[model samples]
Target: MPVLAGAEPFSHTASTEVGVLLCHGFTGSPASMRPWGRYLADLGHTVRCPRLPGHGTTWQECNRTRWTNWYDCVHTEFETLARSCESVFVFGLSMGGTLSLRLAQQLGDAVAGLALVNPSVLTLRKDARLLPVLGRVLPSVKGVGGDIAKPGVIEPAYARTPVRAAASLSRLWKLVREDLYKVTQPMLLMHSVVDHVVEPVNSRVIAEGVRSTQLTEVLLYDSYHVATLDNDAPLIFERSAEFVRSVRQVAA
Candidate 1:
């Protein structure tokens, strides 16, 4: 499957010792995070937004990959940045946020801080439990993409949901939530008042589970699931940058 043009990975290097790793959601590509990555890069920070495995391609292709593959991609990027940058912060959307939390838990102080938007730690829908069984028979289902509330904005995402891959993601969610207390760094969470794909409770779970004393949650009244591309996008960008700076100052 040919990758979408705008969905390619994006990287920028600045002279700063501080770097940021931006992770996009499940079925989403770097296209979903390009604006936010560029905004931070323009501010002179080193940034890397990588296309995850099984993403930016046909839904059939995505079904072949699992959560470990996706996590490996971002984990490698984090390692590369950590070797050079004095401090590295991670920011992610949706499932990407779930991965960021896992990184924070695994690497501890190596991950200076985290900024997440509408992160999912668990599925609120009861049917999601059947994914492990149904995935074997049902290869794909209707996609949950393009849930943005903004008019005329389309997220570059798979048209179908690969049940097997989704089931793999559910496993990752369980592992992340179990060790949430280990992610005790400065944290900033942004969640929409009404999100269609990932429920608002997803954010609440992270807020309540993580032991970060520096946790901050911002409510987005105007945006939906993909707030990074919705009406409050600018606000998400600005506040995230500000949060990164404040965390850096404290570490210094």
Candidate 2:
């Protein structure tokens, strides 16, 4: 929460009837979710998107953290939102989605539902990740600092990819694959069938693995990895809003 994905502060302690905790992908910051958060905030729901430690900073800083630290960050946000809202729904992008799924498994009925965009869980194309030598010798990329990239669109905040962090992801995902059955909360997952990052099969796996009968997968036909900023971002946002409404209806 300290280096909150680059925004520099938390939401004012204002209360709302409904709340959402947004989580960004691995090596990414809350900036990935800021647009979505702002949109949801306009809906009169309190939204918190905390930056994972070592993110929105240097990739070397991120290299020092692991998936557990990332989960801890979002879990704190989740608990904080739970204390002040009547209902809590989680939305996450990429690895952020993986954390959301894990939390839903942990919270069960306590978490109303989830929305995932281009989730990272089964997205890896084999054991391939960042090239170790380059990650070790080369400096962070000049742009989004290990951040998410929307297809054909580029983010200046994104920098270098952290190999150490990715190594951790490779291991953490295996654990998630075995535990997917524990996520039974109603979920609406969105992914691009042609995503260059996470494979479309990842979303399919989520829709099939989670026990929730309300789970659905929305495909972004015109987007790539970072659907959040691509041409289909509007569709992702609307579909996500609808998912929250559907879950809230069920919870009500």
Candidate 3:
């Protein structure tokens, strides 16, 4: 499957000692996060937003790939930045947040901090339990992107959700939840008040599971799931910068 034109990976090198690795959500392209990456870069912070494997392409292609492929992509990016920067912070949206949490668990103290928007950990939806069987019969379902409150904007993602790929994501959620206690890094959790895709309970579970003493939760009043591309995008960018600075101060 050919990748979408504007959905390619985005990267910016800065002179700062702190580096930020940005991860986009499942089925989403770097197009969804490039604005935030540019915002952080403008603030003189190095930024990398990698397009996950099998994304920005046909749902058929994405269905062939699993969570491991996506995880390896971001994990490699993190290792690359870790080698060059004094401190590396991770920021993600939705499933990207799940990958960030996995990295925090695996890297431990090396991960300076985390910033996530409308992250997904667990789903209360009963249908999710049937993914394995459903995936076998139905290759795809309806998509769960472009849930932004801002009009005239759309996230470049698959129109159909690949059931097999989503089942792999469910498996990842299980693993990440088990090691949530290992994620003690400072975290900024930004979630919308009303989201039709990911339930608000997901955020509650993360708050209760992680051991981060500096966990900060902010409610987005006017946005939905994709808060990074919604009306509160500016707030997400500005506060995220402040979060990086505050955590770097503590590390220094």
Ranking by lDDT: 3, 1, 2
After TM-score superposition, the amount by which residue 82's alpha carbon in candidate 3 deviates from its true location, in angstroms, is 0.8
Error at 4, model 3, angstroms: 0.6
Please give the TM-score that candidate 3 achieves against the real structure: 0.98
- Candidate 1 residues lying further than 4 Å off, grouped into runs, are none
Model 3 agreement with the true structure over 1-252: per-residue lDDT tens digits:
678987899899885598999999988889889889989999888899898998998889999999999999999999989888888999999999999999999999889999999999889899999999999999999998789889999898889999999999999999999999999999999999999888999899999999999999989999998889999999999999999989988777
**Candidate with more favorable, higher lDDT: 2 or 3:** 3
TM-score of 1: 0.98
CA lDDT, candidate 2, residue 219:
79
Model 2: clashing residue pairs? Answer: 141-160, 143-158, 143-159, 144-157, 144-158, 144-159, 145-158, 145-159, 146-159
TM-score winner between candidates 1 and 2: 1
Instruction: Quote model 2's TM-score.
Output: 0.86
Report the Cα lDDT for candidate 2.
Answer: 0.74
Residue 17 displacement in candidate 1 (angstroms):
1.9
Q: How accurate is candidate 1 locally (lDDT)?
A: 0.92
TM per candidate: 0.98, 0.86, 0.98
